[model samples]
Target: MRFVPRPALAAIAALLLLASGCDLLSAEAEVYDSPLSADDRRAPGPSYLQMPVRQQGGAVLHTPSGTRVVRGAYDWWTRDGDLVTAAAGGLLLYGADGQDGRVKDRGLNPDQTGSTGEAISALHYSDRFRIDVFSPDLADRRTIVVPASAFDTDQASGSGAELQLHGDPYTLDGVTWVEWGVNSEDDTLTDHGLFRIEGDQIDGVLRNEPIVRLYPAYDGSALMLLRQDNGEDEDCGGCVVEQDLVELDPETGEVAAEYGMPPGYDRDWRVDAVDKVGDTVAVRFRVYDGEGRDATAQWQLWTYDGEWAEREELAGVRVWFQDGGRLVERPTDPAGSPSTSAGAYPATLTWVPGETGDLSDGEADGEVDGEVLFEPSGATCRLGRGEEFCPQLSTTGSLLPRE
Candidate 1:
């Protein structure tokens, strides 16, 4: 903080107080030939909130060479092998047909799942296939391989033959398969085909379209499911649908094991929505729900580490600029923020007074004459002294820090 003596300013404030009855704009020009009233005054305008920025989703497992394939949701993503989905499409991304005749679609699917705010993601760890169904509104699904003991005798027969996945009578080829189940009628389709699970990625055909989701984090020893509930409107007897944030580690294929979502929310709730900078995961939620007809409080923001470890909150607050927007801050919150278009960061405020070439000497102009006086905070060191025309240099060097 800086300490500034306002003895000269006090005199001018008094003059303004007396002149307050008059139209402030019309009485400007000189104000009795003094500049005191001109200090700390702003020409009403705007808060200029963060503009609407574009959000670009990255590829699954971004490599130095560039994203091999843009990631999308399916019901599969693995060691993230580059699959040649088509012979003509540069990569499976456009569409593909492997040299050996295997065909697959490699396009991104944000809505492959049927519902809005719903995302489908896949995980291939060890030898099992993990599929994640995340709904912005409810609990997700997790399915594991049915144990050998649980395999039915009819499944052993491969009746519908979607690629029959039999754990019993070992086949000549040690490889395990999750076969497709088709009906007896040649005309009717039964189930998805059986796929031979490779190391990471899986190659399975299907009579019906199967969901596909890709990931960008390779070497991703674990698979994590991050959910952000926008607290959308809930019908009937339900209140706003509570959101949950989850992280699944496929490294061990631990089913039913993931981070629990915390309760409470407000606007400014966003994550890496715009730029991909900053290591700290930013989340803006409501801290204080002001008293009103509505329970919703103003949005507050906070940043946390993204490494999925843990950290503690340092401080927090709810602030509004009366101008337009409001900001809430919680310094150490974890990063599981929902998708939003608004920003959670603050903008810079600059104070520049006077036009260039206002200086008499061939030097930088900061002050006018001997009338130099510190503001409430002595943090700034002024230059040039004057009896009445003292200009000021904003505090930029070593000085007090702001809250």
Candidate 2:
């Protein structure tokens, strides 16, 4: 099983697929669509914040007793109280649901997996050139296998060719597609593409485009893409790259609409996260300097009106994921200082991104403010209901919603 480890916190550096030669997927490719029924995509049960325990390798499920699941695997997510893990063994689901323990386990290789907050997708190699899709409840599965020649690993310049699944599989008009890419062995450059299994047709759609990041619109109405110019930039010395925010039409594989970035921010900035407000799209990015270094440690949040007209940038605020109609925030007032209290580790402050209104006039003050959710006195972190977990500061585990 071939496994590619990702960096901590952010920046999901995908696997490298070979590139010496390029062509559309041959007719020999096979796609078996087992569409997920409405009942198969059932809403998840009550979720709690689960965090990984540093050095321990497993995660602490913030239940009443702080249940621990998925031992020896840090890459995991929760669906209906079950744990889906990408471990050396394979793609596994550990749960106490109807089944006794492990409910579903598939793939002969160490799968490169991601999720759409509802379903899981894995790009499997070795046994076969295929992408495996798992339903939210692990009840239904779909497989799409392509000819080995389609990858043409013999042509790859470095580290051989390997398929990289971007984000997760998404559905449009009853068809499911997964955004994929090919990156250099060093992961410095990437050629974005798309792959989907619809009916009897399996295709590598939008092959080798300059788009870098593909994410579902915050509102789940469209796909948002950050596209770059294919032309080389000989002048800036990699200082800046022109990019655009556009909504993609999944059915036709084209840009349906373009969203405007704030003046002077259309280039040299890397997108960190994106979400939707009432009528605007909230994007978080880190601006780079001439040397391609992040200019600041804190991520900037900006909002673009839905009409592709107005834009506003929020100051001095860093936002995490949006949970239950509220944007979670982590403040960075005294830059470089994680904790003001002596002998205390940095705490995760949970707060809202203010009210969704005219942000330009600074009426969105609550957007920048937050309250401390928890504080770590030592290695152990204590939360309400007598729940506690010790997280290593080195890895600094993420906050995930789970049951």
Candidate 3:
């Protein structure tokens, strides 16, 4: 063997290790270059949520370029890949090219605006008796007027009637629908109806049915209405009664089937009707005491297809329906607080697979686990003494996907 200095031998060994590392890296590069089918390749960017700054006015918009602020936005939601924002100035729309497609300033923010990713955006003005509908991209605006006579009733008509929108407008089977109610001068809801809009015209679908909430079945086969069942003409005078989930004919708006609840389901309990996910509809059945305090000792995930079934994997977790037929799941706090509030909490948002048309008898798989999107660090503002205070920022349930 040839004599060699120890230092030289050590230096040579280091060089050999460095060359092997480079070879390993080159091997990895080649493996990555192996042809991946387009279907198998992952999307190019990280998804983001447009969490509303609760105490402040603007929104935090995250694009592939970077995070930017849309100033003066009181609230906002997403449609397609665009933003529908409510600002003190007016409702504004931002497209992918950073174009502001605002259709004239409609005065301060609208009374309300909302949309699911698959549904059209709606700006409701009960005072103005009009609704401005926009396409998913926030383009192609259409204004539909709801006449005062549309809510006319024996006891309510003309000026004495107070028109109120029960909830945000929603779309079912290509038709847009809004819920309207006539409140007595005392502010008591006396009559309510489900109205459908087409072009610039509106028509009633179901009237005065005492429906507390309504959702289109995932398959769009039938409309699900959660209605109160008061006994035999009893004038309980707005007292809470047992509730039933009934299926209604989408076109005729007639009751097609009734899913009865267990007796005393409404004695002192409340139901949070989360929207349909996949082949099932998720609902939160909570209990309260006589004094109207939360008496819910446990949280459970209950879904309804033909009948209600308890889901085991997601028990003790709170689930919210996100746009595009997705469910955002978060572990229930031991103290019994909601994730919708301002605070830092752990959350797991899963996007469930969705199906179209009616699959009334089909089975739905449990949600696949997802990574935690973001932990809300409630309304935060600049702490510096001299700095102009930035708007307090907070995370909201309304999450905007990666832009």
In terms of TM-score, the best-performing candidate is 3
- Sorted by TM-score (best first), the order is 3, 2, 1
What TM-score against the true fold does each predicted structure earn?
0.23, 0.60, 0.62
Better of 1 and 3 by lDDT: 3
**Clash count list over all predictions:** 44, 5, 2
Worst 10 residues of 3 by lDDT: 28-37
For model 1, the local distance difference test gives 0.24
Q: Which 10-residue span in candidate 2 carries the lowest summed lDDT?
A: 24-33
Write one digit per residue (lDDT tens) for candidate 2, span 1-403: 1111224311221111113231111101111111221111211222233454344556543322234444435344432445555555545555525232333453333345654545566665453356766674566777766554444233344556555554455554345566655544544444556665576665666666665666654334445667664343343444557666655555556555455454456455666666443334556665544432223333466656533222334433343332231233333332422222211223344433333332342413533344444345444554445433434221111121111
> Scored by CA lDDT, what does every candidate get?
0.24, 0.44, 0.48
Model 1 vs. true fold: TM: 0.23
Using TM-score as the yardstick, the better of models 1 and 3 is 3
Provide the lDDT at 101 for model 2: 38
Model 1 segments more than 4 A misplaced? 1-222, 227-239, 252-257, 262-403
Model 1 lDDT tens row, 6-54: 5676468547856776322112111011111111111111111111112
